[model samples]
Structure formats: structure tokens, C-alpha cells
Target: MVEDTQQPQAQNGAQPQVKMQILAQFIRDLSFENAVATKGAPQGEVQPEITVQVSLDARKRGADHQYEVMTKFRVTSSNKSDNTTLFLAELDYGGVFHIEGVPEDQLHPFLMIECPRILFPFVRRIISDLTRDGGFPPFNMDPVDFVALYRQELQRRAQSQQTEAAPAADQRLS
Candidate 1:
């Protein structure tokens, strides 16, 4: 026999309680290179074309109900015409989160998608400051679509699993 240990809050027709908190946020790593200063100013006014690449990672911490999520950004600027380098900025930022009430199976997406979504503004601000201080206009990053990114990652993982399984199945048939 099993006992039903339902909370009063949920018995009233409300959803289960979910708790999330950002325990800490910090810059894990940062690097910026100003080509205009090092390589000398390029001839003529510069048309800077900036490209920003982003990635995310997450893992459980030693403490229970705590996880660490990291967001990495690689920003590159180049002249659209002659393609000379302007500057490059790379930043790795991390956030420590204290979360509860989410089920184990859903935690992975909660960490990868929701946690980073919560941390993105800080990451964007840092990048903007880094670029502005490096002598360029403030680089405000566009909003990232975490849901789409999560979906793409899931699809990629599924494809990789299928690819791996196909070879093993072939070997088994031999």
C-alpha cells in the first residue's frame, strides 16, 4: 500500500510548486583583442561586421539541488569589404542555480534552456561592455531562442544515436 502525500497547495487545483534561484554568477573567462590597436588602423573608415556565436553547458554541483550553467560567447568583427580583422572577444560566463520541485527527467532541459535564459542578460551586458571598452560601439546581443536551440540539440542527439545504433545493428547481423 502507498500513501498519497499531496501538498495542500496542489490539492486546491494549483500546479505543483517550483522553486528556482540564481545562487551566483561570474565570468569564468574573458579575452579581447583589439586589432586596430595592434595591427594599426585600417585604411578608410571601417565597416565592422560583427558575428556572435553562443554555446551553453551545465552540470550538477557537489551540493544537492544546485547546478552550474555556463554560457560561452565568441564575437568577431571584420571589414565586410576587404575582410580585415577588427577585434575578437571571447567570454565564458557561469551561473550557479538552486532549483527544486522539478523532476529529474526534466532537469536537463531546465538547466540547459531555462537556466541559461535567466543568465543571458548578464552575458549580453558583459559582451556589450567588453566591446564598448575595447573602442567600438556597445554590442548589444539579440535575444537567443533557447527553446529552438534545445530542440535542435535534441534532434542532433537523436540522429547521432541512430547513426551509432545502425552500425552496431549491422555488426549484429553479420
Candidate 2:
């Protein structure tokens, strides 16, 4: 007579599974202003320029094996004078993802590419909405290719290391 507890459960293994879900997303901070609006758009015939800066971070959530990915963006648009902040915005967005029984080889790509890909649309919407509310036409970011972006970033870092090494080599030669 075999004990009921001795019976194997669900394929005799821990069961391969992967689940990625967004826990929450919100604007940690947002600021927008049109200083030139009161000045009637100002004169001097200067073309408008917008600068965008983006940053991303990821961390593990303790023993649960869960992960959190946070992405932030800062965009500022102004005339040549730089005194007017035509459109300025700062957004902090993140998501909580659960991954289990996934192979190590696939984990890197899942976090770098898939996770950010999922969170990007929400972040983009926030930027668009903020621009519209600031009295300017909606400023929508172009769709990002996380796979390509990640590859490019890796390449950039590699090149930067090579450049840094070159300087050290030059010092040795001198």
C-alpha cells in the first residue's frame, strides 16, 4: 500500500513556468511649462530643439525571484535662448515581473528586452499625455526596438572600453 503523500505531482517536476505582470506604474514626477507663451513666442528666429535623456535599472525582489524594472525619461524643449522651457517632462515608470523555472541563457534577454518592451508603451503614453496637457501637440516617442537597442548599447560600451584602453596605451608609449 503506497502512501498518498508518496505520489508524484504534476509531471514529476517543479513544472516549467514563466509569468510577467505589471504591478504598478505611475508618474513619479512631471513638470511642464511654456515660458515663451506669455512673450508671444518670442523673436530672433531660433529653431526649437528638444533633448531627451533616458535611463533604466533592474533589481531582484529578494527570495521570491521576482524582478523590478524601472525606466525614467527627461525631455526638455526650448528655443536658442534656453530661457524658455517650452516642454519639459520627467517620467519614472516600472513594472514587477515574475519568472520561474526559466533557463539561465534566456533570462538575460527576457529582462533586457521583453521586460522593457512591455513597460515602454505605458511610459510613452504618459509622455504623450503630458505634452498634450502642456498646451502643445502630443509628443509621441517613436516605437523602440529593445533587442536592437540592447545590442547597440553593448556595442557602445565595448567601444568605450577600447577607447579608454587606447589612452592608457598612449601613456605607456610616451
User: Tens-digit lDDT track for model 2 on 1-174?
Assistant: 866542454357654566666666556666666665655675667566778787777788874768887777888877766556566778888888887766778887678788888889888888899888877778888877788877887899999999999999999999
Over 1-174, each residue of candidate 1 has an lDDT whose tens digit, in order, gives: 976666766788866667999899999999999999999988987798989888899999999999999999999999987899999999999999999888788989999899989999998999999999999999998999998999998999999999999999999999
Q: Which residues of candidate 2, in runs, are more than 4 Å off?
A: 1-17, 37-40, 44-51, 79-85, 166-174
Model 2, residue 99: C-alpha shift (Å): 1.9
What is each predicted model's overall lDDT from 0 to 1?
A: 0.92, 0.76
Model 1 TM: 0.87
> lDDT (0-100) at residue 173 of candidate 1?
97
Residue 79 CA displacement from its true place in model 1, Å:
1.5
Give the poorly placed runs of model 1, Cα more than 4 Å off. Answer: 1-6, 9-15, 172-174
Please name the candidate that would achieve the greatest TM-score relative to the true structure: 1
Query: What TM-scores do the predictions have?
Result: 0.87, 0.72
